[model samples]
Target: MSFATPSLIDAARSVLIVVDIQERLCPVMTDPRGVLFNGARLVRGARRLGVPVVVTEQYPKGLGPTMHDILSELGDGASSAVIEKTHFSAAAEPLVRQHLESLGRRQAVICGIEAHVCVTQTAIDLRAAGWEVFVVSDACSSRRPESLTAALTRFPAAGVVPVITEMVLFEWLADKNNDGFKDIMSLVR
Candidate 1:
């Protein structure tokens, strides 16, 4: 469990992971509204910057599909690269690895529900599988603050980088003079 990355997150080598932001789970979360809003921001920004995004639903039959609000905002830009899994770790599903491989990305920016469970496990597995994993703290939540805190605290030892939404957005942009800066700035603000 090493927590060292040779360089910063490069968009060309990065993919965004939206995990289990389904209907039932978000509303019951300790910070559902924030999670959805921030998650949506990450998705939108990633799309604008040509970053690949892989969304996941943890058993939609019981939890229902992803929030309609996000889909509506995402509109036609919604990713077809979605994974429906029974496994806590999205990496447990072969498609996820294939999806990331197809994009040729080496880093994953993760956000979504159950910070202490699915998100945590996926980050760990992704790390073990040789992917640089970054978990967006503000864009993730659990039913309890303690649980979320525990996961964030333990992430570093698992070789997962725990970061805030703005940190990811800024790191992705990398330059205020870049063309996408204004758009990403508006989205985050």
Candidate 2:
């Protein structure tokens, strides 16, 4: 029997999407600190590797802005863009779709809050829209643990790949010889 090799995320073809890890929503999540830590790692690693980042804020006026910690990791915002969205699925937002398209990438690494709602919907829609979707499992959460469990269960059938923060950082690095290797390693260490 022959098996095809699964694809790894190529830094050049990938974009990191931070979804609704906002001020008002975060403290209520199942593991807010873990999510924030790993999400920040993803953001910093993506920046160091030159991967474009897109951050989504769901009803920022109500939820408040993306948490300060995540925002701080974005590093001067030159390589990242934030879209304020009312839609549960960020892919359904015109501006979000347009921004992702403009990045010229087909692989998306996604993380953030309300896993069963915004995160899951966005992952499924992005997958259907022809982007290879990797949902960062450790960097996503819900107010309830069951909801987060449900979202992880739904991913396989919806064609979303579940991944962790370190998997993404090392994959983006691709080799120990890569220039960003030590910087990426430090995030996980």
lDDT of each: 0.86, 0.92
RMSD of candidate 2 to the true fold?
2.7
Clashing pairs for predicted structure model 2, backbone only: none
> How would you encode candidate 1's per-residue C-alpha lDDT over 30-106 as one tens digit per residue?
99988988998888888878787888999999999999756655556545367789999898888776777787778
Residue-by-residue lDDT tens digits, candidate 2, 1-189: 222233898999999999999999999999999999999999999999999999999999999999989999997767799899999999999999999998889998999989999999999998887778999999999999999999999998777899999899989999999999889889987
lDDT of 1 at 87: 90
How accurate locally is residue 162 in candidate 1, as Cα lDDT from 0 to 100? 90
Cα deviation of 31, candidate 1, in Å = 0.4
Error of 1 at 147 (Å): 0.8
Over 4 Å off in model 1, which ranges? 1-3, 78-80
Model 2, residue 114: C-alpha shift (Å): 0.6
Give per-residue lDDT, candidate 1, residue 174: 90
RMSD of each: 1.6, 2.7
